[model samples]
Target chain A: MTDVAVIGFAQAPNVRRTDGTTNGVEMLVPVFQQVLGQTGLAKEQVGFWCSGSSDYLAGRAFSFVSAVDAIGAFPPVMESHVEMDGAWALYEAWVKILTGEASTALAYGFGKSSAGLLRRVLALQLDPYVVAPLWPDSVSIAALQARLGIEAGRWTEEQMAQVAVRSRSAAAGNPAAQLSGTVDVAELLSRPYIADPLRAHDCAPITDGAAAVVLAAGDVAREHCARPAWITGFEHRIDSGSLGARDLLAAPSAAAAGRAAGAGTVDTAELHSPFTHQEILLRGELGLGEQVTVNPSGGPLSGNPMFAAGLARIGSAAAEIMAGRAGRALGHATSGPALQQNLVCVMEAR
Target chain B: MTAPLSAPLEISFDYTRSLGPVLAKFMTALADRRILGSRGSDGRVHVPPAEFDPVSFAPPAELIEVGPEGTVLTWSWTDHPVDGQPLDRPFAWALIRLDGADTGMLHAVDGGSAGQMRTGMRVRPRWAAQTSGQITDIECFEPATQPARQSAAEPAAAAAGQAVAAGQAVAGQVADGAADGAEPVTMIITPVRLGYQHTASTEESRYLRALQDGKIIGQRCPACQKVYVPPRGACPTDGVPTTTDVELPDHGIVTTFCVVNVPFQGQRVATPYVAASILLDGADIAFQHLILGCAPDEVRMGMRVRAVWRPPEDWGTTSENIDHFEPTGEPDAPYESYAHHL
Candidate 1:
């Protein structure tokens, strides 16, 4: 296995809706070119390519198939796709690198959530025969988890409000963030709930976006960037899909992934928590310390692109290391209902 | 400049699942309006029973009726709904263990609102308007008014195993264990009917409109000099757009061939038919199409085929316009001529 490092990362400005098709070719083509250009690596140079997206999100089956044209896969490329976030796509790419299949790889994820009601499409992830028949909206499901945590005295509504306040404030500087501005936690807390416990601001806005990350082998990494964000550890796991079978307030998958990835200490961390209370839930689950600065790019609350948000989190975390803003960073992604699946990637400047 | 177009689209298909033995019995019991669970040797009554015992890897023998009513072990409120769901309105989704069952079954509960639902609330089955040997036989579960039955046994006809259908027999063998020398069996013909909003890419939409005019258009890749039938943003080889417009004829030849004798899922043609890849003379790639107007066995490699179009009145902006390929009856080219193109 070769020591792979993130050489380049690029993303489109997250928006509430993009006129472009849900296939994400229009949104992703430019970002693919941007990342390749930044690393001076051509698309043909990428030995292996993998993508993460979902059929439900695009309101169609085999949605990723059409995106093949974006790659110009005529002769065909060694590629596979996961019905998951782009973060998992990165995990597959890393696994391919570890197995010595490819030296340079590209991972991407994209989604246009506004094509249909975002929350409604997500319900399809539940057990198809059983729970899926009820059609639970994601916000209501998250609220149920949030209410349990609040009643159990794990966290307060004010604290949840504080997380949103800080995330948006931090996002003010990020040009690509969909929602960003300075606001007091008390003023935000005064707003009415959209799903009882969670305010509109507490939830991630529906966004259309795409993200691309380029990884290279040790020698290729050294040649591409002055400070390559070497992936020190990468691990992921999926818990049971049954919402009733597992604890919602605590993400066992995130904790398992974090411990496996050695996500103990980091100067900066990017967490894909579309809901504010989830940020608190994940922090306690991963056992991150107070020293770790979470969501330096304002995170998913500012603009959450369903399939691409997790990959954007990893890309942003690597960006911090590349820009010399942080020495070590942790990137986390989640999937399924209430963080049923998770992936943690730890990177450091080398 | 005009109002955006929208229409109601429904993608629904009754998937015929071969349940092997365990699930088949379960479905049969459902048809009889009874809930049955199979008990493994370890004494676990699994609802919609497992085909193979998780622990002993043996098929279950004991069948029991756990309950028509069960408590919700855990539940989530559904405020939004998607197409094809049991309820098109808000409801509580839950995992309920029937009175006699060990593992819980997932279904919708008619909680109506978040305030009416709790994790431990009990619910009963709401059978469908008409019964079918499908999961939809049970519409959903609703709040139950009373507890479940406690009988150990009830008067009923003895259960008997029936001869597996030929189609299901192959599926069962494949399910229980991998089989060798299995002639490509047509186990299933799943007609997938997924309706997407099919928004074409900007360039492709333009080409589709041009196709409506009965013209063949090709986009030329500057680097490779290959003209693509449909314009692409990235050339498959160079990963760059095919920048120029070039016209190509609709005629092509058979590059390589495969006789799809074995019937499979979503087959549009009859059994023992030949589905081959035809390379349009000017195009670099070959696509699948049916070889028609000839016996299935008579279709040969390098057999020249041409697009037999439907009547002009039946034309549409789709590849379906070319109904099927018919034998051009030209002399067969030598095998070595197009073997490499394969």
Candidate 2:
């Protein structure tokens, strides 16, 4: 396999809403410029382009295609899109580089979660015939998972509250985060439950944002940056979709992906845990010990921009290595209800 | 910058599905107020029966009546309800393991309060006031008011192809899910509705603003120098926003077109009209518009045409301000001039 390293990463400001259109061109234009500028690579020199986004978020079909306008794709560049999160798109770009198709590639994702009732819209991802018709909102589903773990003695309500407290406090340093401030665990615990077992603080804010990452193979990666987060392993896995079939407290998919990706003890970890308890479950599943620093970038609970948040996790992890913050880092992304799908990328400074 | 023009947009569709034999049997049984599940190869009965056995990877051979009464495995209370849920009032959503079934199915439980809901509480399917053989036939599960007792025919009844279960709430239950032997619920229709606030990009908004003034405006790409009417947010070739707005005449030549002989939903024009891409005078790109005032057969590529505007009073920030396009009676432009657009 080619030695592909993340050469640059950039993201738009995470916020509850943006005045931009759903196609994401406005959110993407600035980030594209920022990522290219960070790598000191010209747009014409990049070889391949891929993106992740969803039509459901846009409420229009082929919305991602219109996002290409941000790239000014005239003379048509080689491009592809996935309805999945941008982390999966990054996987596509990584494969493109490994296959020797492109020396340098760019991957991006964006979502205007503010365009629709986010939690309500997400219900569409469930089983249409059996599950979706009931119209179980996303928060309610997560609440179900949280209650299961709590009842199973896997985690506690206080521990879940602590996760939120830590995330918001940590997010104080991240300008791209949507929710950040000093918060007390007890104060969060006292808050009324939005969905029985879950509180407002326990849920990631609905954010509209975009993120981009640039990758290069071997020598180009080395020449462009003094430090590159070299990709050691990238793996993704998925479990059964039925909500009743699998154990909710255990994210078998994340555990399997983490094991396959060699997500060993790392100095830093950027996990995509939209719910507070999910962070605890993921930490146990991925085998990240207490010594490992988690969500210094505040993670998704601080600011989750749907399809873009997962990709930003990878980029944020790479940024840590690029900035000489850690020797090795792990970035994890999840999709579907109760973490049914997961992708793990382990990176090291070189 | 001023906020881009925005409007509420609602997209809806009715997704039609055809259930296979296994689900067909399961759904058809539900209409008859019975609960059926597929007995997996491992001897575990699955509720909302799996079409194929997860372990064996084969179609389930046995269909069993699990329970109308069951225990709540896990539940979360919904204090505030959203649209389309089984219950509009406050309720608990639970996973219920029905009698004689090893696996559980998710359904709403009308427990009324958080204190009343628990992991081990007993519940029973509250048959809908009316059932149509859909999963919603069980409107929701309700806490069982009667004592929980084991049914008699539970074990051998399923293997015997009996639709009745033992020690369950079902009494005098009809076994005929498909008495006429008609194809079991082969089709189901689900209506999907979503709402969004659609925002026009800044450049598109600018073009729309121009349309309100009864003028045609195009923008020039700083790098490629191509003119785009209804200017795009960024130039396709240059990766830059078009900044220099240029005004052009409404008259142009049709680069290409198609005669719409077939009709579709929400089409305003009658059949046999031409929808053409018009290359506005001095603009490098063409935009779609209707061609009228002539027979559809006469609408040809490279033909000269001009916009026919609606009365000025009716004009707004919309391209609909132009009713259609009509021929200028001038000879067609040379095909070479607009060939690149095609």
Candidate 3:
């Protein structure tokens, strides 16, 4: 079987909003070119394409279909889509390569989360019969989880503020981050709650952006980029969708996926935690050692572009290896209410 | 203009769903002014019952009665509420571990302020004036001592089944109106509404701007050099933004088309009208538009047509500027002229 590696990756600048259409053509086109340029490959060489996005976020149906314009999809391309974060889309691309269906593949995810009331739109992901009818917004839902963690002594409001401070300080170096600046944890704690126990800094800013990654199997991967980040292990898992039934403080799904993917011994981790407390919870669930440097790209709290943010974490992790910043790294993504779903990708410089 | 054109867009839909057996039992209990929880594989009961045990991956072993009272495991204060929430005013959203259930259920706590709500606070259901099988059956939770309106739960003890059906009353599936079933929460209508500030791309904005001024403009892609009307954000073949504006004649050939017989929501055109893909003389791609002033059968591939503009006063930054297309009476272009587009 051919071993697939992420040969190149690129992301658009995360911003509160873009003047472009929800189809994400403006954001995705440049990133596609950037990734292709990094690999010294042309768009025509991309054999399989997949994407992740939500029609609810775009305020339009089949929004990803229009996004293919950025791929230069003439003569038609074998493509697929997931109504999930882009990291899941990358899994599909990797499968295409490993199965010998394609030698080169590209996976991308994009969203104009700013196009709609993001918290309200997210309600659609809940159980259609019970919870969604109540329309409990996403922030309040996260706050509920955050409070659970805080009350249970698993994490605290002060510590959650520290996560924001560190993420912002780390993000100052990432030009693509939407929010980045050094702040005293004291100042963050002093801020009033946007949703009780969750401050403005604790929740990721709603952003509009896109990202794309290029993958190649074996020799083709070596031909494009010099130090490819090989996929040592990749796995994903989901918890039951019952928000009331699952333990709010525990991300059993993340832990399960981490254990399955052999998520040990990575020096750097790019986690997709939209809420600050979630970062703390994920650190424990994924069992990252205290010494492990997490979210050096500042993670989603600094700049979360919804559908694209998860895939960007994977790209950010691969970049650490490709840039020789780390010998091994892990990328994690989440979906649904309160980290109900999770995917983990572990990569290493081989 | 430095800023692209943008407008408020509102999209809405109603989704109807049927409840499975496990949820049906739960809803029936709610209607009877009682709460039901399912015992999971772990032998713990879950309120707002789990249809299947998460740990066991099997249907719950049994159902049990749970709470009208519970303790707040954790809660968050919402200072300002959005539409459709359990409460419009300030409230605390809490995970309440109802009495007799091991797992917690989520609902709003109608506390006066944040200072009043705390973890481990005891609360009780503020029953609605009218009971419904829906989650809203227990309006919202309030501090245990306060009674939430008089219990309208037992509207008529004599009419047990009728009262239960009334508890299930909702828009699409009016309880009394449903096909007879003692415990079928078979229909749920979810109304989804979203608002957006929809913006046109720089290339598309230019095309639309020209359309407003009564002209047809297109852009040529620098890489592929294809002339595209309602110019694309990226050239579909090269993935490069289209550059170089080109003006084009409205008269063009219909490369392909379909005669509409089915009617859908928001469709203005009459049935049997032709929806055609017009390939303009200077453009390489086809744009969808409608054909009128000719029978649907009269519309054909390779036929020449011209835009029949709405009265000039009716024009704006909209494709509606062209009311429809009409036969131009000019000779149909050779099929080769548009075979590439088709």
lDDT of 1 at A111: 92
lDDT of 3 by residue, B54-155 (tens): 788798888888887999988889887776677767888888999999877888888889998888889998766655567777677889866555534553
Worst 10 residues of 2 chain A by lDDT: A127-136
TM-score: which is higher, 1 or 2?
Answer: 2
**Pairs in steric clash, model 3:** none
How would you encode candidate 1's per-residue C-alpha lDDT over B26-61 as one tens digit per residue?
A: 655564567777787888877766666656978877
List model 3 lDDT by residue over A1-350, tens digit each: 57889899899999998999999999998898789989999878889999999888888778888888888888788999999899999999999888888999999999998888888889878887777766788999999999888877888888998999999999999999999998998888888999998999999999999988888999999999899999988999998787777788898999999998878778999999999999999998999999899999999998999899999999999999999998999999999999999999999888
> Every model's DockQ, to 2 decimals?
0.20, 0.43, 0.54
Q: Name the runs in model 2 displaced over 4 angstroms.
A: B146-183
Error of 1 at B299 (Å): 7.5
Name the docking class for model 3. medium
lDDT per residue for candidate 2 within B104-147, as digits (tens), equals 68888888799888899999977665455677777778889744
Score candidate 3 by lDDT. 0.85
What tens-digit string does per-residue lDDT give for candidate 1 at A27-115? 87788889999999877788889999988778767989877667767677888898889998998998898899899999999998877
